[model samples]
Target: MYKLMASLLLGTSLTCAAAAAPANAKPYEHVLLISVDGLHAVDLANYVANHPQSTMASLQKTGVFYPNAVTTNPSDSFPGLVAQVTGGTPAVTGVYYDDSFDRSYFAADSKCQGNPGIEVNFAESIDIDDTRLDAGGTPGKPMTQIDPAKLPRMLVKGECKPVFPHDFVRVNNVFEVVHQHGGRTAWSDKHPAYEWLNGPSGTGVDDLYALEQDSLIPGSKVKTTGSFKAEREFDAAHVKAVINEIKGFDSTGANKQPVPALFGLNLQAVSVGQKLPKAGPGDDAGLIGGYADANGMPNSGLAVQLDFVDHALGELVGALHDSKLDDTTLVVIASKHGQSPIDPSKFQPTDEDPYTKMPGYAFHIADDASLIWLKPEERAKALTAATEYLKDQGKALGIGQLLTSNQVALAYQDPASDTRAPDFIVTVNPGVVYTGGKKIAEHGGSNANDRNVALLLSNPSIPPRTITALVQTTQVAPTVLQALGYDPKELQAVQKEATQALPGTPF
Candidate 1:
């Protein structure tokens, strides 16, 4: 009873004398967090300015904008999203990439044994066998570079367990923070594995919905850019889930559900659109691919995506207004990461696998550099050789700078301290797009173009203004706490790291 009383007080009113909610007590009863993957602040500014009637434009006029918001380093969706949910960097959260190697974790075959180490790819792959992490395309349409055999995977403790999205993360998220305090939560994203956002409680979202777009779907329908029509259609289920959840009903056909205190979904349409090739007949032109102009301005493909996201936002806003929840709900629109090498001429691909040729070291290469894990016996020797080899390769290998094992440990965390910390971090130049597969433009680096994403938060009470001061997505977690009336310290990561609430927010 004491806990319930506290929840009521912190969530709504300050009236201690009476249990009744004051007439103006409710400033915000619901918080909606949305992420548009691969969206840049510049894209938001550009799209809104050009598409004035769009939901984003409307948000610009009334919502607080972060013109200089940046995502966590490595700028991959996994690490980037972890920063938003956990309020910390890779050091604080133990998250660096979706497909990263862990020195302490052994392969499934060697689980719990005196296993050396293993590579772990935390994606939709962990969900089910033959999960088809890259399945799409219509019967006659072209196909993407989906090779099931090539998809990254690893068994854990000699068993195949699904790596829930939050499994690798080392801290709590807003969902768990709110749920434990008597608040309801819901979320939807690209894969069932996204169940990770639920935080450490392992049940952060009360009404969780996830879909695997990369999974194979049988039909004449093919995917567009980042996903197929069917994929976007699946994500729509998440949008509908939020609407229903707001009405006190379960999105999974259960009724009599309570309104969620926090809820949101990812709109992948923009990401897919940004990567979508101008549909055509030759040069794999029929296939959906993302390419940019020399100046990095998006062509029609990305424009379509921007409009789609805005339209989805408008629909959700309309739903809120229809339910009379608009005035009481807080709307947040942001991105998991930003797409990079925006200039068309900047995309470059290479297959410089020096580690595979060596005996004691293995590596995962992406975004023009490699994340290397050395054998326990030769850690020092391999580190030196790999660093020197890549350094010598120089622009020929498209290498930029190598963050040595010790340098990374000091900057991120010691591998001895954090097994998730890769031994070395290789960063490529801006125009360099290293690929073993199809994606032309990419992210997952410390560069500004890769990490500069769009972020905006809104409520009826907030006076809209664009903020140019540097802000980190890590600030959103604690900011969410403060906005919801919870003690910012309620978030362990926020408390330990001293993450600040977003500036200019009413809270």
Candidate 2:
């Protein structure tokens, strides 16, 4: 009888406190974080200004819109996504680029012996254990490269590990925070490896549907000696999974009980065939079998992808409405990175050139843009050849830009330490794109066109307004945490001083 009386008194006091609170006092109960891999802010602006049928434009009419959301440097998908979810920079998260070098390990037979493989899992690599220590061994005698066949064994033997996002991110993500607070979580995306963005253990989310089976490949599709479809059916399957989860919430009274408090979905069909249609001299067009005709013009593909994503969102929103939880749910639509132009007819591959002969060298184009790989001993010579090549290519392509080894080092130079950067970095003039001989649109570098992406927030509590703040992807995680009423002080203390709160959110 005494216990019951105490419980009743506590419930009454809680009710009184809630009633006395201000109208804007209720913290958001659910947060939805969506990442469109290559959606551009400029493209969103154009859609809002002109495309009346755009779903994004419709959301903008009801939410806080930011037209100048930029990503951190290196602007690759892994780093961009990591920043968005962690509210941290590459300096803190260590996701510098898609392809980078690890000095600890070296391949006995390969020239690029110490380079780390793509798809780094930051959290797993950075723990107290030295999972990501250079492959060759330590910082001084790191392994230069691993034999392709030995990759699995190395991972099993714990000899080599992914760097950057996999090894570098040191903290829990916003989703994890929500989960810790008793909320369920789920995420769906084209790149399953993205699960690592949160951590190696896939913390925060209880369910994940990585649409592609293997994300290490350049394109998120299975390659059967080259012939492949740009759009994988698995994308649709993931959407179905999302729908099923939402439906399950309704059937089980999960929302009223303990449904997913946070969720995310990624749609990838639009960015699938990003390459140009034709192959040029010395290009790897034949390696992937002659290119297939693009399903539609690049712009058309984007529109379709957007529409498809919208349809899925519409379904999810409908589920929320039916569940009677619309008012408490906060939905965000954002992008990891933006796309660049792709015109394959201009590609020219040359083996006679020493720069082109370097490891990982694909083609030497005329746009101050060329892909080359160099050894540590050859770094100086490669830099000279790259600068001269850029001068000549700049005049030919009408874009005066050069990316030498010095420039590459300067771009990625650790503000805290002096370390050698990528052997060769492609610096392109405005409007020039690198196909990597794939003929599809791609983004893995730092450029205004590649770094700028979209950001939208919609919820009942937020007053509709357009914001033009210089928001970075790194701000997303902290913003989400703040919206959920989590103590963001810990995250803020570790983040850069410029960390931003979500615009128009009552925190």
Q: Which candidate has the top score in TM-score?
A: 1
Candidates in order, TM-scores: namely 0.84, 0.67
Tell me the number of clashing residue pairs for each predicted model: 10, 35
CA shift at 49, candidate 2, in angstroms?
4.5
Give candidate 1 misplaced runs (Cα > 4 Å): 1-27, 129-166, 220-231, 278-296, 352-355
Q: Model 2: residues >4 Å from true position, as ranges?
A: 1-26, 49-54, 105-172, 200-202, 213-233, 248-257, 273-299, 342-412, 415-424, 436-440, 492-498
Per-residue CA lDDT of candidate 2, range 1-507, in tens?
A: 563232211111111111111123436777778777666776567656676666666667667887767765556666677677766655455455544443233342333344522222222132222222122222111122122333211232554432323233455566666677677777775443444544643455666544332322243232311222323343555566555566553211233324567776765544442332332222335322211222112344344445566666666677667777667777887887765543334334322233453433422322123333444444445556655665665544434244455554444443113222344445454445443444444565445556667888887556778787556666677667766666554453134434555555545
In model 1, residue pairs whose N, Cα or C atoms come closer than 3 Å (at least 3 residues apart or on different chains), thus clashing, are 108-155, 138-222, 165-196, 166-196, 223-228, 226-272, 275-289, 275-290, 276-289, 277-289
Q: Cα RMSDs of all predictions?
A: 9.0, 13.6
